[model samples]
Target: MAELTGRIALVTGGGRGIGRSVALSLASAGADVAVTARSPKELDETAAAIRALGRRAEAIVCDVSERTQVDAMVARVKTALGDPLILVNNAGIAASAKLTDTTDEMWDRMLRVNASGAFYCTRAVLPLMLAAKWGRIVNMASVAGRAGAPYIAAYTASKHALLGLTRAVAAEVASRGITVNAVCPGYVDTEMTDASAANIVKRTGRTEEDARKILEGFSPQGRLMTAPEVAAMTTYLCSDVARGINGQGIVLDGGALQS
Candidate 1:
């Protein structure tokens, strides 16, 4: 067991991808985790994985974009399990689109889920964290946030906003024993990247293999980061060893974004 023994953690978007990996990583470190996602079925899988690690899991169904639902989610988490000492605001959405082609719905959806959702979840959790005098918040950002991608205008803006929020909150809560940070990953081997790569293949009329190579070229390592690799950083940030690591946007881009 790692240093997170007995700690309670809540991970939004815990059903799949990096979020699911982060949840399991926390459990492996001896934390009791609450996994939240829009689908109960998916959340159940994450919970089952946690249970397999001999850790308790609170499976929660939540759509972080809705404020009312977010409030209810916080209440429910506290009610069913306990106050979460660590929060991973990993819920997000991205669209590959030009600014001119972006619709109001697309832009708003990106912002609501990627940026505003983090705000709401953080707001809901901060009071309790302050009262208890300890907390760790990790927001998932992307390489698009740091550099201008050709498309994905809305997604880029939203992730940039999320990174800003992460820094601001970390500064505000520094004296409260709370560390707020953002993890910005470059091309990750997740569903989102799969979709992006597929789109590139279609647009360029190139083979999927070639398109994947082009995407992978964005990383200096010429490869995608694994969810478990990113999860390791997240779990570390929540541990006692990372008390001084605050307000930083930790990029997992395989040297794509030097920071």
Candidate 2:
């Protein structure tokens, strides 16, 4: 039998990039999946792909930063496919600016979406996991969470808060059969990275290709990490085999920031 044959998973930001990949990966592992994001079109595509894998799937439109929306999304998932046994907090946004240039609005927005969004979603689904005595929670964090970087203070701070939440919750639930962990990938090949590169081009007058190369150069492997690679790690963490792995931030940056 498949590892997660009877489980249900909820993946936020499931419309595209790593979230979409993780949702599909969980479905492939035999779990029914419900995906949430703001984009109906992308969520529909992701849901369609999961259904093609023969697993039950639901696509929900949600803005995770709002507690009401998060609660509603989880309730909808429960009604559609039972309580989610696995939760992937992948909904996030990023922007780069010098610390002095960063606005109050930008800082607030960063924490609202990247950190608070995960907290709200996790809080909503945690009760079901605790009651069942089994759960896997994976937060899609970033390398910035671990170390400092230039021009991304707000993004970095939000991710650090997320990691803090991961450790605290993992410790809280360690004895309760629930594991919480984070995946911190550096410079992923996603639309988010593309936007970053575009921003670089605009600010530095560098060609798009050169801007991309600059981002890729951050990883020792000289390439951006693929969504499937992150998804594979997330799926493994959600499996029975990974029950012992908890409260960890597994880095995937090709040997960068080893500590």
Residue 109 in model 2: lDDT = 95
In model 2, what is the error at residue 186, expressed in angstroms? 0.3
lDDT (10s digit) by residue, model 1, range 1-259: 2499878899999999999999999999999999888989989999999999999998988889999998988888888778988999999887787779999999999999999999999999999999999999999998777888777889999999999999899999999999998888888899988988899888899998998898889888999899999999999999888999999989898886786
Candidates' C-alpha lDDT: 0.91, 0.96
**Which residue pairs in model 1 clash with each other?**
97-152
- Best-matching candidate per TM-score: 2
Question: Superposing all C-alpha atoms, what RMSD in Å does each candidate have to the true structure?
Answer: 1.0, 1.0
Tell me the lDDT of candidate 2. 0.96
Q: Model 2: how large is the Cα RMSD against the reference?
A: 1.0
lDDT of 1 at 69: 90
Model 2 worst lDDT run, 10 consecutive residues? 1-10
Cα distance off (Å), candidate 1, residue 189? 0.7
